[model samples]
Every structure is written in structure tokens, then in C-alpha cells.
Target: MNTTIIEHLACLEINNLILQPPFHLISNIQWNDKGLSFDGDIELYSSDIRKTDFIGRVPVQIKGTTTHKKQHKKSKIKHSVNKKDLEVYYKDGNGVLYFVVTINPNTHDRQAYYRSLAPLDLKGLLDKLEANGNDSITIPFKKLDNGHLERVCKTFIQVVEKQPKQYIEASNKMEFTDYTFNYADIQEDLFDPFEEPVYIYGVLENIEIPIETATLFEIRKKDNEVITIDHEEINVEYELKETKEVVSLIIENSLTCEFNKKKKTGKINLSSIRTLGSYLKCLKLIKYQLEHNKLPFKPFEVGAKINNKKDFKNVYDDIKMYEELIEICNKIGLRDNYVFNEGENLSSLFNGIIDIFKHKKYQLLNIGDNRKLENTMLYNLKLSDFITIKVMFVDNEFIDFFGEEILSKIGGLVPKKPINKTTAEWDPNNWEEIYFKASIYSNESIKELQKATNFSFENLKLSYTDQYHDIGIDMTINIALDFVNYFDESLDSRFMELALDLIQRYLRKFPDNDLGKINLYIIRFKQFNKLSEEEQEDILEILERAENENHKNICFACEVLLQNKLKARKLFSSLDIISQTTIKDFPIYRLYQNLG
Candidate 1:
């Protein structure tokens, strides 16, 4: 009649249920002595006994008691679970299987009952507890049987996988805290006009706040006062806002922290944190403080383009999609952060995304409000007179083009390909890309940015999606300079890469052209202010080589990027006597036009 014996008996029953035949052998149960949030995990495999066949795992917890007609309900076993456990599980936003086994005191005859506490159901229960005083919950677990075993296991496994969880094992051992233990949640949703809602998830979450020195931020100085520092820079004084304690931090170009969009990656410098374990503890503390709205800033900021108030929904969708993209890096089980290298074999995750674009079709609406068309200079003159940006989303997954109902609703395609999967070249010369992903920002997104954060909001003008953008740019020296000066920020990375490729082709034919190398350096490493410190070092380092080889023109071009107007003007003045050009054609002329 011991409670411990009854508990073990219940555990044994679950074990026996898995081991016995006829029920099928695709599932296995793992039990532990004590559970924090779960007693054990139940894993489902496609095959009978291979690790590679793992579908997913369902976290399970069980309780047992001997009852002599102890106020029992029909087909139910009542049990009390820890309030803390319920809180932990509720925060996770994942499903848990609660099992209760009741044993008759005299005969030790037992019957098992189960209740799958789904995330929404947990939310409801937790909401009730939050409304009232915090207390433990007594769940009335329902009937469970051998016939229902596989169904239950698979269902909870789906629940676990579908839940938005940003999980990554630290590169080093870390302390287990709220961040490590808690389940991450999808914050909210937004809709767009041209596109239906796309569910975006964050791959990185609860990242600890890193202190940055004041010198990390710099102001563009007077032209005459431009100071150039090499790769390793000077020490800056850092004052902790909370403690007001000033400390010295040595600034290295390589140590600059920011997302590398060019490479689609990011990294956290772990030198300051002694070990990953301490970072975890700090993350827990930060999350706790942040929830209380005590923190001044988040670890990082996200910018979006939403034109109108309703367009804010479009921004939210993109945010979710970006989060999902970052999740791919986590799912790939590769590095701790995002890295998309040229020629690296794309994973199934990338395939899923490329599948969305390379295949997913939209029925071009011909009617009033639904009929959306915009002017695009790339296709304005040649390809089509009208272009409607259509984003197709359905059923939480990118639907395949097979048996699609899009045939009769017919519209024209750019350089037409089959309706199903298109193998269209991503060539810039022909403007063959019909579908590709773009990052957008808008004022409406800025408003929501205010609503979502406790930190300060800055009104940033995201470069407008240029309808005037066209390919096959003129390669003459002045025209190339116009290309870099005018379109530096708005220039698409694809277009930039193509321009660099074109420059390379030009260099091959006329191998000794300084203008060719200058154009290559200008456009290839365009937008000096935009590049991260490390990227800036790359440009400066290349310029140093040009200096060694006595490449005067190339060395001076680096000054144009560095905004050393005094030096750049001295070199440029020799060529242009008339000076008949707008700042857009040559922004280095800002030096000649403006005086301090």
C-alpha cells in the first residue's frame, strides 16, 4: 500500500506497454527518478530502433496513488502537479502529457489515465492562476489505453516541434537558467496588403546585453579633421549606465558586434564573458529584468519598412520570416550564428525557402482592390508595362505548385517559364528574376516598433524600393562613379555583385586600366559608412596595397570613401576643370561645396 510502490508500478506499466507487441514498436519511453518539468521523455521513431529515424520527442510526467474508492470520477484519475512545474511548462508554450495511474489498495489493480495539456489549454489554466493567487493545479487526467499509445505520443511530438523554440547548445558549458529552460514564444502577428500574413519566428532569443564603449559610436567629423585609424584602434572609456562606473575598453575592428547582412551571419564576442555558463545566468537575469520593464535597451534592434498604418502588418510578417530564417541556422546544427557562404551546399531549410519563391504562384487579380500593380524601371520599358508584387502563403507551409488552381486566372511571366517550378536564371543583364526575397521598411513599422519595445525609437527612412532600378549599367569612369555615389544604399547586393563581375570582365580585356580598378574598388566595397568596422578594415587594407604599388589614383579613391576631402579634392581637381556635375554623380564634391 506504499505510495512509492504504486508510483513504481505505474512507471512499470508504461514500460511494459512499450515493450509488449501488437501495439507496434515505433515508440519508446524513458523514465527518470524525479522530474523538474517532466518525469521523462517519450521518443517516436519512424523505424523500430534507429536514432536516425527519430521523428520527435514528447515530454512526459506521471503520478500514481492507491485509492479505496477515494472520490473517483468516471474514467478519470485526479492528481496535483507542482505550481512551479506548471509555470515552467506554461512559459515554454509546448504541450506536455500528464499521466495518472490509480491502484486499488487491496488488489493493487491499476488503471492509467492521461490528459494532454496543449499550449492553449495551458495558457487558459495559467491565465486563471495568474488572475487568482498563484497555486498548483489538480488535473483530472482522462482515460488512456494501449490502443491510444502511439496516437498520444505522435500528437505531443508534433506539438513540441511546431512550438517556436530558439534552442542552441552553447559552444561552451553554461549555467542553466530561465533562458535555457524556458520555451520561447512567437510574440504576435501582422498582415500586409499585397501579401497575406507570413509567420516569422526568431532563431535568436533572450540574447544577453553586451556593453559597448562610447567610442564604438562615432560622429562624422569636419572634412579637414578626418582622422584615420588602422585595424586595431584606441582605448575608449565605457561608463555603465546603471552603475555609472567608467572602464576602459580596447576597440578592435574585428571585435565590432553587428549582423553581417553581406554574409547573412552574426557573432558574439565571448572574450568579455569568462565562460558560456556565466552568459546563461546573465541571460536569465536580463530576461527577468526586461519582463519587469527595467532594462533600458534590448540586445539588438530590428528595422522594417511599412508604408501605411495597415502596412505595419507587412513589417510583422517580414520580421517573422527573418526569425524563421535565423531558425534555419539553428536547425542546420552548424555554427552558433548565421553563415551563408557562396558554393556551400544549401540545407533542406534553404530548399524550403527557395521552394517558396522558385515555385509558389499567385493568381494575378484583375479586379478592383485586389488588383495591385506598380511601376518597376527594370521591367518598365522592356519586360512588362505592369508588375504586381504577389506573395503567396497558405496552410502554414509553402504550398507546392502541383495541382494548383492558378491556370485559368492567367497573367504574364517575365521571360516566361513553366507554372510549376521555374529554373529561371538569376541574371542581372536580362532581369530574369521574377521571384526573390526583399527586406522592406516603413513608417507604420516604426510606430509598432514603439509599441513593442521599452527602448528608444528612432525614425529611420528605409531606402525606398526603387522603381527606377535597371541593369547593364554603363561602365565609363564617370558613370561608374555615379552608380556608386547615387545608389550606394539602395543598390541591391545582387546588382552590386553583378557590377563587380562586369568590372572583372572589363579588367580582363583592358588589364592595365586604373579606372577599371578604381570602379571595382568603388562599387565592390561601396558605402563606406554602411560597412562594419571589420569590413572597413578590409577596404583600408586593400588601399594600403595600392599605395605600396604606387597606384596614386586608387589610393586617392580610398580617401573619397574615407571622406578625406582635403586629400581626395587635391587628386580630383587635376581632372575636372569645369566641375559640371551634381553631388549624386560624385558625392566627394561635398568637400568642395561645403566649408566648416
Candidate 2:
């Protein structure tokens, strides 16, 4: 026989051997031009009994090679397989390949050697193709003696046995009180085969009884429907004795769940569901304790009592108290319109109002602690109180618009005077003290106050003297003095104008005042020579009047404005002889001394 015929005879013999007991092979099917469509699909069966029990099927392709000789010091078996055929088998998912080689095909004493393709074996064959730059790859096969063939069959059986089971049986036992539901049944369809068993057990109770139980409930969406265990109906019920409220647990998806008690239902997202569930469980426990005339000894009962306080003092004394009330609301399925009443104390009342504010979804700009102030109180408060509180909540956008640090500093100011009096007893004049501490007279603070209060800066300026007396003038002159001392070429033009305006306003009020002239002299130092003749003469008269009056600091400050270092030094030396106080008492004395 020729080489092809000899190879065919060996394949037929091998095919007959595979059909003996545990394997059922289908052959005689037409393949493509490559040879046979597939050698056959081998179905594994249980061998202990006469009745055939199918386990799994492995689709396989077979190749035969006859030439066998030592190449590169090893037994070599060469067989050419089409590139397309190899690719199809590699990607088939259900397919495997067997390469068979029959040694000494020309002689009657031919022996068959074979190799079964494993999942990762294709990579090696592809590597061989790339290394040789060939369209087809040659695979090596081991001698397929009876012992090796038996091991291969045993391995195949083991692989089939290692797969996941097609069916699962699960059961759980649970007990509940007589007043509550005894069973829960949940049914869901999971179309995929079961890889492991699932068991769910829980006792449902009425809200009237208090009971503690732990349970796991999760929902996932698949193809637009909630799925859990392959189409299986899961039933869970908590029966309550003599209760008219109908409770239902509805699951929408992994992230969403709803609990309904009577006509009330609340949708809870994943993050808050655990707390909600715990609160509901506590409510049930509390009811049980009440019905039995017990001490309400359950931990959840104590927690429920603490969490369900209606008074504000209990909530505001602790920072995290609001979280407990929110949990109770969620557990009881409270509506969005649920009203929270004020507590007896102001702090509690504030927190109670905050609950309402949050329930209404009010967005308060966090200026500082002003978020603690309710919008309802804004219009009701006194104008001074309203303005003070309003400053605390200025947003960044308004701060950016005013462009001043003093405004932000003022906004953060708390009153140094204790709030010892009741709201009714508060004096309106107290706000002047508060505003003073807040540096309200500073131009930047004034600008920011104007923006917040809708009152003009000029109105604030006029009110400053009326409310604060000489303290307001001192604030204005001190700010002007800061501008003079720190004057630089890079100062903003608008800022310079504001400084000059402040100084001029003070001078207009007290034109010949020594402090006012000193501030003007310092501010107008660079422009002193450029002033109109009358302005220069007025300034000269103020300097002479101060000199004759022995006001050495004012005289020294005015002479420095003339850019006369010698005159400023001589005037300081003259002050040492005529003055009873030390030169250190006058800051201007030290300033001129340093300049000289």
C-alpha cells in the first residue's frame, strides 16, 4: 500500500480502539478539502453499567504522519496542517486536535504515535510557524502505546468531571415569633447553570413587634429585569398577627430598593439602605417590647428611643445627632414634606429648622457658620443682627468681586461681648461695638458690607461717625496713615483714589486739625510741590502753627513732606530740649530720625 493508504489504515485502527467502552465516536462525515471535516466528536460515558450515561463531548481533528527519524537528536514527526484549519480549531472553544504518526508505514509492523492538543498547545505551534516563516506548522507527537493511550483517556474523563454541576439543591431552616410572619420566599430567574448552591432564610415580622434578625438581600439587573438565581422563585414573608399595615420589600436593582409600610413607601439607594434596614428592624423590636409589657431591654429599643427624640436640645447638643433622626425618617418611609418642629432650646430649634431646611432641599451658601442660620429668620431679625449674620455667609464670588482681604476678615469676626441678654433685651448700640471689632470703617470692609447689605458705602460712611463717635474718625485716619507709610509705585490706582478720598473727607470735616494735616502731608508728599499756590500756603500755615504750638511730631512730619532731611532732624533735636516727654512717645520722631 502507498503512504496515504497506510496512514488511512492506521487512523481506522485508532478510531476502532477509541470506540471500545467509555467513548462514542462518530465518523464517516465529509470534511473540507483539507481532509475530514473532523475525525469525530468523542462523547464520554460512564463505564460501570451497561446503560450508557453521557457526560460531555469533545470535538477533535486528526492528522496522520508516517516519516519518523531522529532530527536534531530527537525523534521527529512532521505533519503539515492548513493555517486556516489550525486557526479555526484554536478558536473553536469546544474543539481539540489529535496528531497521529505511524512509524515504518511500509512494513506491516507499523506503530502509531499521537498527541492530543491542549488549550495552550496552539501557542507553541504558532511560534513554530513564525520561527520557520512557513504557512503550515509541524507538531511533534509522542508514541501512542497502550499505557499512554489509557492515561490520555483517563485525563479526558477527569477534565469532564471537573466542570461545574448543571443543577443545585439548597435549603435553610429559620424560626420566628407568633406575632410575626414565619417565612420568606423569593423567586428569581437566573438563566445560567449553577456553579454553587444558594440558601436564603429570614423571618418577617410586623412593625408592632420588636425582633432582631440578620439577613442578606441583594438585587442585580440583567436584560432589564431583576435576576438572582436562575428563574427560581424566592419567597420571603414576615407574618404579623392582628396588624392592618401591609409591608412589602421591593427590589428594583443593585443600587435601588424600596420598603413600604401601609400607604408609605421610601426608595433607598445602596449607600443608605443598611442604616435604613437597621432602623426598621429596631422599630419592629420596639413594638414587640411594648406589646409584651417588657422593659424595652433590646439594644435597638434604646437606640430607637434615643434616635426618635422630637425635642431639639437632644439633637443639637451632639453634632452627629441629626444623622439618627434622618435614619428614623428613612426607616419610617417619611415623605419629603414631613415637618420637623422646633425644639425648646435655641440650639435645638436651630437644628430642627435645619432639618426642615434640608428636607426642603434649600441650598445655603456656606459663608462660614451662617449656614446654621435659616433663611426664614433672615427677614425677621433686626437690621444690625441681619447684617452681622449676612457677613458670615458671603460666597467666594462676592469676595472676588470686592477684591479685599479686610472684608473676609470682617466677615469672620465674632462679637467679643457675650450674648448674655435675651433677643428681646439686645441693645441696638451693641452692633457698633461689634462693627468696630470687625474693622467696619476700613474701606474694603465698607465696600463688602455695601455689597452684602445693599446699602451704599457712603451711607455706611455717614453712619460710622453717628454710631461710633471719635472711634470712627480714628479708624479712618489710622487707615489713611497706613496708606501713607506703605505707599508704593505699584499700588492700584483705584485704591490710591480711595485713600486720597478718605484723607480729604477727614480734612474737610476738620480742615486745620493737626492729625488731619499730618495725614495729608504724608499722603501728598510726592505731589506737595505740585499743589496749587493756595494749597501750598495753607499747608505752610498748618506747619507754622504746629511749630509755634510745640507740636514737634506734627512739625517733623510736615517738614519730612518737604523732602528736607536737615530740617526734619533739627526739629527732632529741638523737641528734645523743649518737650518734657521722650521722643519715643512720638512715632513720627523716630520716623524722621531714621530718615535723617
What is the per-residue lDDT of model 2 for residues 1-596, given as tens digits with 9 covering 90 to 100? 46566556666656655655433433332233144345665555455423465555655565544544432133334456666666565555333546464545445454555555432344345556778887886554544543334345445444323221111011113344443322111113211112111222223453222222222233322322211222432222221111123322222211222334455543323222223233333333333323343312222111112223242233223324434555433322232122322322435433543443335323343324455543212221112222221222132211112223323333322344446542434366665454333234444433334334333334333333333333324566766554443344234344445557677777787776778766665555544434455656766787889878977777777776555789877876776554626544333443454563
Q: Model 1 over residues 231-250: C-alpha lDDT tens digits?
A: 32222211121111211111
Among these predicted structures, which one has the highest lDDT? 1
What TM-score number comes out for model 2?
0.25
lDDT of 1 at 464: 16
TM-score for each candidate, following the candidate numbering: 0.28, 0.25
**lDDT for every model?**
0.43, 0.42
Give me the displacement of residue 54 in model 1, in angstroms: 30
Runs in model 2 lying further than 4 Å from the true structure: 1-426, 429-472, 527-529, 573-596
